[model samples]
Target: MSLAVALALGTALALPAVAFADADDSDNLMRKKRFGQNTGTVTTNSNTGGHSQESGSKATTETAVISDGAITPFITADGAAAMQAVADKYAAVVAQGGWPKVPSGKLKKGSTGKGPAALNKRLFMEGYLRAEATEGEYAQVFTSATEDALRRFQRNHGLSVTGVIDGPTLGALNVPADRRLATIKANIPRLAEYSKDIGNRYIVVNIPAQQIEAVNDGKVYSLHNAIVGRPSRPTPVVMTPLTVIRFNPYWNAPASIVEKDIVPRMTSSGASKVMRDMNMKIFNGVGGPEIDPDSVNWRRAVVDNYHFRQEPGGSNAMATAKIEFNSPFGIYLHDTPEPHLFHTGSRFYSSGCVRVDKVAILIDWILQGQDGINSSRIAELAETKERLDKPVTNSPQLRVAYLTSWPTRDGVAAFRSDVYQLDGTGFVVGQPLPVGETQGGKRYVLKPIPRSLEAVDADEAVGFASIFRRSSDRIDASERLPGASSKSTDSLVSLKDPKAKLKAQGRDTGKKKSKAASNGKTRAWTGNRERSASEVMSMPDADGTTAKKPGSKKVASKKAKSGDKSKTAKAKADEKAKTTKSTKVVKKDKTEVAAKKPDAKAVTDKKKALTDATKTASADSKSATQKSNTAKAAKPADCKAGADGKLPAGCKPAAAAKKPPAKPEKTAATPAKTASSTN
Candidate 1:
């Protein structure tokens, strides 16, 4: 009995171990099906699946996967809940009658128009105006209540809150309820996907809305306006930890900007003018000797081959601070010199980087736990105008996303325009992963890399000048003001050799000769001939020594001959007219004789023939009337006895007459006597 109990205990322990092995195998199969093969190496966890540690390293790996699933690192639980509430509210609004559209015009205080009534109705539906405040049939007057309601609506929709129904306000109000609902539904999944595992502290940048929020402990710590990337150079969606914040950092212009923007400006505006105005310096290469602006060939030196660095100052492109983050696309957040852009309704004007408003506040928040860095230290650095680097000990995670609809913590849902169209139905998927090494030790396959500026064709490297110069060159010289110099002509002259200069002068003389000929000037030719006395008498003498050009004398004589011939032709035409008049008179006389009256005997014969015809017609009418009466009298009665239905004697109906067959025509009779004589 003891031996049997020991075997049973051992079998039970083995069964649990076998079951665990089966579960792990199943998990591996599911992962493979979802994400394909495990081509990448996975770090093992020393604690739980949520956390891991590398061998001999204190750095812990924060697993992206949360309790539910792997998600974008930026979304928070409170944000997702807020979005759900907004979606539900908009759905209910759709169930009821949707919001009314305000008319397409401006509405200010004291204005009495139909647009004001519509605006009031919209505000009431959106819960910005009280029902009692909108009393009356028309509500056409734009009262104080209406202005206050408009202000609230604008604030909620991320507008300027001007308290007037301006163009932007009217546009936001006119968006249909159905579209708003659809936008909410489309973005709800995105919120759920990205907001799943966001920790207690992080930053959220919404590209479509151009806003950023720093959240801590389920609440917004600070909010600021942002200027994101333009459409052509869109800001990429990424989630990475920001590691450093630099004060008064230098701006290294990217290669693309140098090739496309700076090069053209330098070429047109002159290198010295551009560098001085922009506070930029040209270097031979990275960390190489700084070159004098005048020494470089502004016209021929390729901008892509050189490096441009802007000095750190208040006037620099990146105004004062830069927040460093690891991204393969080389993107980051920084401050800008143009702070007025933050007040605009739409602020997408950067070249793939984000420009944050109130960047000092953000830096202070990011460096909360760092050594020797705080708001006071930042202020001191700004006053002194000194460049300083501050490393963030507790680096916060940043998620840049394109979300058009979001909900506030108070359960108020707001919808923004889909500027980037990233709500799944957009042309692009999400922000594309960067091409090179990513933050999580993963590499993304991207399209063929863009060719370097040096690799591009020489003609193409000139950019806009190569495309537009030819068209500008075609403008006529006469259109320019008199005495104005032509830059292109001057450049051409400066480049020409002395031999070419002489040839150009000869060409100009030939052009003048053609112009004289076109003006009808006469040319003189010389020959070995003696001048006759008559020729000399007819021609005009020049100073009594030289005669007039022979060409001019010949032209004058030809004109005289032509005049005499014209006179002879006119005389012949007059003589022909006289002959034609005489012939017309003779023809008229013959026509009068032909048009005389008809003969008298012919008229008398016509009258006699008419009388005979009248008498014959009267006799024929009398005979036809007598014959019709006799036929009517001889008609047979019905073949029936009166009221007895018996046949009458000798009253048979007459039979219809049959037509006789036609006879053959007779042939000409043969002349037998003539035939006998011929024989």
Candidate 2:
């Protein structure tokens, strides 16, 4: 028989046993159905349902047994294939099971549907599974065992302990198996690029999944659902370490956020008052360099002017608590007033910072005080509200970071959305992946297993000599250290103290010097010594040699005697030089004087002639003015108007002498007229 025929024969033999209840349990023989009754003996040929065992007779339907809560065929052969197909779609969820248990309600008997299984797994991956224990003996069943496993899965994946599977779980389970696998594999390429090494303690945020995983010592320490930035303002991808946790942090409004979200909202009528209610501090970003909110035209300005900030207040997006880090991305973890947002499966909703679910729990871990900030004391202080107002002990250190890709337990690459979508997309900064490749159009995908962080010198050098030079300068300037001198050893410590402050400040200071030193001028004090001292000295003389004045010269007798220009004549010259050189060569000998006298006298005579001509012109002008005045005095009295109303037209009464002519009005004199008078 053909292969198809052999399979049909096997089904035929299996069919009869199902109809005969006496073949198995005693309870099965006395079958009384709630909806129907079973009677007598029943027989049927099963070799072929399409044709009868006896020729010329119609084929009869085979009967199935129902007993002991077991159907004759628990599952059809084809149905088993269908179940595997469902499993394939939720491969990511199943893979997560290696670390997490199955969520509650996910494996309940009535809940076992193809769609639900996939969704349950998806919910598990997102850290949103809520599991509850199944009720009754039903919990003892294998199905119940699976449900319990699902609950463990939910807890492991960072979900709440709700036994029943929900829509989130169902969505996770329903992910197509190929797509799920693809997502994992796609991230593999970016594994090495994600972090130098994830370090002993680091955070991993999966954007697609919207969850935060805290891994330490190659194991998951804690997990939490995170509310990431909105699509328009997605979280960025970067590598940073946690260093501080600022409790009751004040929000310094970033300019872009103020422009996009704060300004317009404020300008809309009652915004200022609302912002005041929200404890926001407004600043001006446009009018001047410093952002002064009061200087802004609040009457005409909108809330979106890019200068508003929600100060340290309960309603602020930055929250009362802050996780301080030094990442260029400037992200931090914090608490939110709106804790209910965590309940929903989707938590991606923030400006750029990460909003943590169960933040208090996470704080309990970071603040354990073993290595990082002691968070417990900070929480206590937060309650009292007095610690932040003054100095308080046990402050938590926070370090916010941005990581787009990371590894799974099995070393598979994982990627998250570039929630803050910074312009740069790449492996580090420049090596971006081809478009439509990874989640960020960047190259953070699964690759070879990542290596550990590179070896960096934890022992920082104090650069004592360099530091001493700097301090000595300040000392010379009479400026003391910013603090009062104390006998305490800590008073002498500075940024060089590595125990408390981050390594970033020192590293940055080092880098800044590198570029500045390259030009060679910043450290070229020795190169300009002579030029700098030049101002303190006297001027040079002819022939380009510096001249010594009489005050600087010492009295000395001339051994050579007067310059001998042939004995006697030279004697007088040499004698005179000796005396005059003492006064910067003021003395002149008779021979030298006779030689230059005629030329000097001629120059003097020319100057005297020029002076005499100037004096003669001055005298002539004065005499002319006096003569004119005398003439005016002789003629003015008789030239007045006649009593008969007739006057000499020629004399014109001297125009009453015109009071020496009033000064011309400024308007009457144009620039051209002034130029003519000057000419």
Best by TM-score: 1
Residue pairs in candidate 1 whose N, alpha carbon or C atoms collide under 3 angstroms: 75-195
Q: Which stretches of candidate 2 lie over 4 Å from their true place?
A: 1-107, 110-174, 284-295, 298-307, 358-364, 367-376, 386-679
lDDT (Cα, tens digit) per residue for candidate 1, span 18-65: 011100011111121111111121222212211111111221222121
Q: On residues 1-679, what C-alpha lDDT tens digit does candidate 2 reach at each position?
A: 4222322233322211001100111111112221111112222221112100111122121221111211111112132233334334346455655322344453454454443444344443543343422334332333544555455433323333344556544443344435544444433323433434344555665443455555444443544556665553445443444556556665555444443344434444345454665576554442324344434443233433344444554464544465554433345566665655555555556655677655655655555654444555645545543324222233322222333333322222223334334224333221112222233233332221111111001001111222334332311100111222322222233556674243334344323333333322222111112121222123333234453433311212121222232355555456555544442324446755553333456456655655555566566666767998987776645566678866656454333443442233332334324222211
Pick the lDDT winner. Answer: 1
For candidate 2, the 10 contiguous residues with the lowest summed lDDT are 17-26
Q: Please give each candidate's TM-score.
A: 0.50, 0.38
For model 1, what is the C-alpha lDDT against the true structure?
0.55
Would you give me the overall lDDT of model 2? Answer: 0.39
